[model samples]
Target chain A: MERETILSVRDLDVKFSLRGRKLNALRGVSLDLYKGESLAIVGESGSGKSVFVKTFMGLLDANGWIDGGSITYKGEDLTKYTTEKQWLGIRGKEIAMVLQDPMTSLNPLKTIGAQIIEAIELHQNLHGEAARKEMLSVLTDVGITEPERRAKQYPHEFSGGMRQRVVIAIAVACRPQVLICDEPTTALDVTIQAQILHLIRDLKEKYNLTTVYITHDLGVVANVADRIAVMYAGDIVEIGLCEEVFYEPKHPYTWALLSSLPQLGVKGEPLYSIHGTPPNLFYEVKGDAFAPRNPQALKIDFVKRPPYFDVSPTHKARTWLLDPRAPKIDPPEAVRKLATEGVKGYA
Target chain B: MPENENREVLLSVRDMSVCFGKGKRIFKAVNNVSFDIFKGETFGLVGESGSGKTTIGRAIIRINPTTSGDVIFKGQKINGKISKELDRRVTREIQMIFQDPMASLNERAKVDYIVSEGLYSGERISEEERKRRVEKALQEVGLLPEFASRFPHEFSGGQRQRIGVARALIMQPDFIIADEPISALDVSIRAQVLNLLSELQKERGLTYLFISHDLSVMRFICDRIAVIHKGVLVELAETEKLFAHPLHPYTRALLSAIPLPDPVREKNKVLEVYDPTQHDYSVDKPSWVEIEEGHMVWGNEKELNRYRDMLKA
Candidate 1:
């Protein structure tokens, strides 16, 4: 199926000034967000997955700035948005964000209904009873049992799962074309996490909104995401269809990430783990940033950076192992089984 | 796990209940829970937040007072008004590793002091011997010995968590109560900590009461697992047995809710929502029963009979 690109990012570089030192949070990252597709960016903390999406809504910190490249959406260069006034036009109506912690996301002072109405009035141009009506509908849309009574309650009265639903309601109230959920289910329980994921997918279909999920947990996004992007050291090491990334992963980092899952582990053996920490962004990264920690790193991986190699028409990875001249190396045993027998091998 | 008769029961909680507040505002966090953890095995307690899994762990470690029932560790009741010698023994033999390493450790104090804090309470040791023990603990948890001098703010999340483990291991505890130990860690880092814990268990023959909400990790590490909901244990069986035959509705619901790593299987999976109102317990009260050998479930007589037939089928 041919799909249209909703947003295109090219060689985007984001840097933060921390304690008088330049930190390269995002280093020459590029990707395309397709219309109405759910793309998941998987990485550990400080891997720049959050920073990458923060650029879309101009949500970068005061000390952080876009150093280079462009973010093109709806025939406009988003990187050129300098003022909050200019960004206000694209922030909520075009793109909305649901943050990780629902406890801090909502106002404890105000009622849940009033908060959703505020978003509707600010973005949807509705007011008074109409805005209130829209807020109630949004609450009902998010699976709240009693919309009328729940609207009158404060955030403290709701459970963690319920509070997350309110946060989603507020985001959905803006009626944005694209919705970004940053670790939406990390703070929630397993049963509630599954329900919230299902709610997000349903909301996406109902509104025809393109969705982006940013999480460190790969298991949480397997069922929800249509595509997967593996990020390491502020770079997109691999991007592919969900099945391709899980089954036929090429990057050693991707293999390590897949093999590190506890679900793929044997009872008596140690689970696969990355040995060292991520490279410090304050210093210049040489060649591949993940090479120092990657056990299967090729010799040249430390000298020169690898370019994106096409594994298929829809899948691409950045690794020296993909080069024809590189020696053959096998991924971990678990990852090999993922390729041969799919996720069933571990199951 | 070995046969029940052959293996020794390391810790047994009989009708344990933990309550909070008093009078009309009273709350029972754990209501009449009972289980036995065998020696040299990881006993898992799986439940959601507010399910009293953490509360049970706290009660075992004497952080929370139990209003009723008893906690017997090696054939001795170790709760409420114990003797001074027994108190000292309990303090030394049982240690807890708290969740959220970022908050568990003292930010102002150096790692050396935080780890040796327990040692000072029991027996007095020379400063040189304390330092040596600290170094050994750090090395066992895969941290550099030099890190003992640095404050917790200097370490990353995983490193700080390792410090927490070192602090617990330094006590040479026989049983460890780990409360959501790896939940605050990154995915790759969780593997490292889990491997360290299992290795330490093998070397020391430690029994662990592992309390967590993540079932996937529990399946990997736990020998026997118990499913708890709203302070009540609904099922208890070996890890594989519980997964294969979930007799309780809540257990089945939780199992169905776990997001599989496989996309195709996940997409095809059907979710089960458990409703408490499904059981007409107003007339027929519920009780814990061993429906099969070593497999327990909480249900009334009618529901227990139905479960037996389902298990057979």
Candidate 2:
């Protein structure tokens, strides 16, 4: 398959100024988001997964700034676009973001119709009736029944699932080329989550928009993502196709996350939990940030950082254990079943 | 789980209903829900957000006021039947672990004082004994003794959740209502907290009314599960039985919706949507019926017969 790269991010370094100290939120993060494909960034909280995606939209906090690297979108360097006015031209029309909480994302006071129509008007040249027409169709497009009635209603009148639909409608109003969902279904129930993921996938195909999902739920990532990137301590530890990451995962952090899944354990048995929490991003990370908690950490892992080792043409992982001289280790027993299932295409 | 006749029922909620507002604006959050938490077993209550799972958990611990129906603790009808004086002393045996550890724990108060708050209200104890109990609770939750001097704000989200667990364990309560304990935690930390809860149950013989929306987590921890939808009991059975043979449409829909960790399986999976309108309950009001020997499901005549056939097939 010939892959079309919609967005190329190279050695992106994002830092935040904290009380006179500099905290690097995203460190040398690099990846390509193929057109019309969903790439999920899976990691724990504060792993810089959100920061890595937020750079694409220029939505970083006031104290934060892009320390280095380039975000090339349609031949434009987004990192160099300093002014909010410059961002206005490409923000919603070219790139849109779907946040986790719909309550904050959607306007509570305004009618759903008014919010969607306003977004449509901002990006498109559609007038009163045309904009309103587009807004209602978008609401319907996102799988909300009775688009006319739903548009007239406020956010409180809608259920949690319906509210998320409204948020999606607003994001896709102008039909952006790229849709970055930051934990879009984390707020929704399991059943509603499936509904929303299906809707997003359908819309992604319809619009030919590239999808980037930032989430902690591995289940959601597996269901929605085409490619997977494992982020830890602001570093992209692993990146590959969804099957490649899940079936033949290389990083120890990925193994730890997979083994920690409660479903992997039997009744009355202890779960495989990682030893410690993520290191504080306040201080500069020395060597591998995951070494202190990683069970298979080598002596050199504490002294020097590990570079990316190619597992396959599509898959790559960063770990000292992947080095040629390092001792071979298999993924834990709890996770080996998952790999086999992925290989066989079913359990 | 042991035999129904052999095992003791720690807490039994009969027709427990929790209503919000009144008159024209009235809404029944939990409608005539009934279940039993057996001794030394994890009793899981699962449903979507508005399904009133949290409301039922609150009612059991007496945090939420009950409008009607009876909540029988041991052999006594405790809900709305007990006087204020008896309520405090009797309800002390029931403790609760909240979803958000940050919001539940006091930011200003030290860990030791926050944990001993329940003890301060209960039977009087010596200051030295109180210190010993607090230390023991912290240690049991896998925190160091020095952490007792620190405040809630000083700890991370996962560590603060451990503090919340420690606070509940300090009471040495018979039953604990774990309301979405692991849902608010990170994926990497969820297993550790879940294991701690399981250990506490085994070590202390504590019965847990584990309330969560995550089905897989429920399957791993709970011995028995009750599926609730729109404030109504849909199905109640043993964990393995319920997962394998989901009699209710809502339960089946929920099961199908959960995206498994395996990618190929997830990609091939198809979810069936459950619509309540498809069910015609006009002829007969849906009531809890024993579909099999132990599995119970709420349905009218049409659904009841269909569920039995589905179970067989």
Candidate 3:
């Protein structure tokens, strides 16, 4: 489907003023989220996956500010957004964020109904009776049965799964164009997680939500993401369609991440662990940030930064190995088999 | 006979139940759970949070008192209040590694003191001997000698977990109750910790009552597994057999719910949602029944026959 890009991020750079030093959290990160498609931003802690989304929503902390780049949503550039007036217009009305923990995201004192109604009234022009109706409808739409009764109950009355549903209900109350979920299911049980994933997928179709999912769980990514953005060290090392990134991965970092997954069922076989820690963000990053951990790192990888090389028309990777002049080296045997005769052939 | 059957039974739990609160508020967190761990094997207790898997681990170590049933370690029943001599014997034979290393380790204490906490109780070792044992325990968990002086805050999550492992290893216990040791660590760190654990187990010939919500990790490490749901033992079998042929509805649902690393399989997967209402358990009381050789399922006569037919088919 050739859908219109709902949000187009370009040359995005974000930094935080920690202590006396300026730490670059996101560098040259770009992504184009399409209408009614889920884009997953995957990375470890401090990889700037959260920072990238926070920038688009104008939710970046006080110490941190956008260094450069533009996040073009609708006709507005989100980078220029500052004042409470501008952020209020965009934050929940245009783009809504669902964090990992629902407890912190929700107001414990207020009832779930009040929160949803408040969000709806703030964004849409619904008032009193109409607002209550809209809020209840949204609550039901997010698969919360008996919306009337649930609305009267506090967040504490609901289970973790139900609370998350209420959180989703609140996110969709304003009927935002984009829904940004940051590890929403990491804290939930696996069974509950499946239900939540199903709920989100249903909501995406029902509301035509352009969803940007920030998670480290590749399995969850495979199920929901139409496209996958593999982030490493404040950089999007690879970005492509879910199929392209999984089956025909071009970046060595993507390969390592894929191989490190524990669900392969290769019993008793020593599982692969990615060597070395992520580059310290305190100092200036030279060349490829992953080059130190890259087993197939070339001499040029240390000296020069690799540009995004095209694997396919839709797929690109930022690794020296992707360069035409670089030596021909295949990913590990497991990853090679995954790229070729792999489960990508299945669902 | 398999080697497990012939080998000495390390720990055997008989109809153990753990309940909390009183009267109307009474809740049985673990209900009549029975399972056995053989020598030098990883016995996994798989369940979701609040399912009482953690409670079972705690009950075996006598941390949370078991309301009913007996716990036999090395053919001797050890449950409830016992003599100090018996308590010391139990303490020496078993040790526990908690889920959160940060919370379990005292933030104010140094690494060496935390690791050698078990020794301070009964053992009358000299300062030199204590230092040597602590260092050896730290080394076994893949920590450095230099780490002994630093406080808990100084080490990373995985390193802190290693310290937790070192604390447990200080006693050199035959059995270790590892309660979700690697769940908190990052993926890369998880593998490193798991490898370290497996290496330590092999080196010491250790028996682990490995408890975790992550079935994927359980499959990677456990020799045998028992699935728990709402404080009841739903299924028990060898890891490979359990994965291949899950009999209970809960076990099947749990398996299908586990997202695989493979994108293709994950994308095409049909997730099985297990609902308790789907089963007709009102007619006959459900209990643990051996459905196949070395495989147990918690079900009534009707469910067992259905499971048997399903297996035959």
The DockQ-based CAPRI class assigned to model 3 is medium
Give the higher-lDDT candidate: 2 or 3: 2
List, residue by residue over B1-313, the lDDT tens digit for candidate 2.
6776678888888888899999999999999988777888999999999899999998987778898888888787788867876687565788899999879999889998998899988879999999999999999999999999998999888899999999999988889999999898998788889989999988999999999999889988899999999889999999888888888889889888888888878888978789989888888778988788668899998889888788778
Tens-digit lDDT track for model 2 on A86-194?
A: 8887788998999999888888899999999999999987979999889878887888888888788999998888899889998999779989899999999999999
Better of 1 and 2 by TM-score: 1
TM-score of 1: 0.98
- Over the stretch A82-155, how does candidate 1's per-residue lDDT look in tens digits? 89999999988999999999999999999998899989999989999899889989999999998999999999
- Per-model TM-score on C-alpha atoms: 0.98, 0.97, 0.97
- Candidate 1, B7-26: lDDT as tens digits: 99989999999999999999
TM-score of 2: 0.97
Q: Model 3 over residues A62-97: C-alpha lDDT tens digits?
A: 899888989998978988877888888888888998
Q: Give the clashing residue pairs of candidate 3, or none.
A: A343-B264, A347-B268
lDDT of 3 by residue, B1-313 (tens): 2755577888999999999998999999999999889999999999998999999988988889989999999988889878888889898879998888778899999998999988988669999999999999888887898899999999878889999999988898999999999887777778888888888888889999999999888888999999999999999999888988888989999988887666677767888889899777777878898888889999988888999998898
Off by over 4 Å in 2: A341-347, B83-85
What is the C-alpha local distance difference test score of each model?
A: 0.92, 0.88, 0.87
